[model samples]
Target: MKGKEILSAIKKDIDEHVGEKVLLKANSGRRKVMVREGILEKTYPNIFVIRVEGNDRTSRTISYSYSDILTQTVQLVFKNNNVAI
Candidate 1:
């Protein structure tokens, strides 16, 4: 999927699920998105594993590139799952 599409899908999933978790398999070099002040927390074309805990609490988001991914499965448990990424 394209970059915006991937990000949007992941964001929407997080919003709908509340305190649930989701994973996004994205292209490498995607982690430049979450960079901090002169520091890099992650590197990409990776799978972004995200967990939503509620009320602005720090969610754990890590990305792994496509090449690095061994296996992938996407499950939409609560409907509204047609959104692409």
Candidate 2:
């Protein structure tokens, strides 16, 4: 797939999985990575949101673009089957 096509495909995949539990892995730069468990919240034309709960019981949402997935800067795995979405 071309760049735009790939991004659109990623968006569609996430759209189909909205409201499901997901494990997120994000690269934070300098060889650091952040991992979190969250619910696939919403998807906009340009980005998708995930609702994550902190260890302290506070919940917050994070948003990432489909291009992030295309570039492997972020990854989403379905919690049910341990498969990357």
Best by lDDT: 2
Q: What is the C-alpha lDDT of each candidate?
A: 0.36, 0.91
Cα lDDT of model 1 by residue, 1-85, tens digit? 6756665555444345533323343333534322111111332334334443334665544434332322223322332443332
Task: Name the lDDT value of residue 58 in candidate 1.
Answer: 58
Write down the worst ten-residue block by lDDT for model 2.
1-10
* Ten-residue stretch with the least lDDT total in model 1: 33-42
Candidate 2 residue spans exceeding 4 A from truth: none
Residue pairs in collision within model 1: 27-45, 28-44, 28-45, 29-44, 29-45, 45-65, 46-64, 46-65, 47-64
* lDDT, residue 35, model 1: 19
Clashing pairs in 2: none
